[model samples]
Target: MTVALWCILIAFLLPYLCTYVAKISGGFRLKDNHDPRDFLDSLNGLGRRAYAAQLNGFEVTPAFAAAVIVAHLAGNAELVTIDVMAVLFITSRLLYIICYLVDWAILRSLVWLVGMGLIVGLFVVSA
Candidate 1:
């Protein structure tokens, strides 16, 4: 797959990592509830932060995927542009996760902005 497509794949998995952390850290039991949201409400501290990150990860997916698809369809995106921006987005997201887990709100926000910018950059390149 292209690097951009690989980025999409990685993006798809990002939320799951947070979910895994939340589940393991929070020690959520499968029988606790049938509803996922209800189960998620039990998270606290780092687990809660992870849940927030996971939510952000899911929230960002549609826009990121659309940007990538649009860029690919526009036929304006260079491989380097797609690859570099994808890497930047992924790196920023990874850092965001770490910052969130550590309770570094300011840094996490900045990192989130960087990732957003990279997402926009992907759209720009495709345009």
Candidate 2:
């Protein structure tokens, strides 16, 4: 598969990584599994931020995946261009999670914008 396609897989999995962080930091246990959302909602500080990031990750992943697929299917942009943007989007998401955990709101928003721009750029390049 293409690197961009691989990135779609990474994007899909990123939220799970954030979920893991939230769980580990929030002291999740087997009992919490019965009501995981409630357990996640009770988290504070880093755990809460991680959970929020996880939700955001899930929100944006589909768009990123779609952008990559559309770019590939359109077959207008260079494969390298699409791949690089995909990688950059993933990098921005990682930074966004770190920013959220560290309470860097402004930086996190900027990183989020960058990710969004990368997604748009994928479509634009395909044109």
- Model 2 poorest 10 in a row by lDDT: 32-41
Candidate 1: regions farther than 4 A off: 30-37
Q: What does candidate 1's lDDT look like per residue over 1-127, in tens digits? A: 7888888899999999999898888887778557656666777898999999999999998888888878778888687788778878888989999999999999999999999998888887876
Q: What is the C-alpha lDDT profile of model 2 across 12-126, one tens digit per residue?
A: 9999998898999999987767777777657899999999999999999999999999999999999999999999999999999999999999999999999999999999998
Candidate that would win on TM-score: 2
- Whole-structure CA lDDT of model 1: 0.87
Q: How many pairs in model 1 have backbone atoms within 3 A of each other, for residues 3 or more apart or on separate chains, i.e. clashes? A: 0
Q: What local lDDT does model 2 show for residue 83?
A: 91
In model 1, the Cα lDDT at residue 13 comes to 96
Q: Best lDDT goes to which candidate?
A: 2
For each candidate in turn, the TM-score is 0.91, 0.96
RMSD in Å for model 2:
0.9
- TM-score of candidate 1 on Cα atoms, chains taken together: 0.91
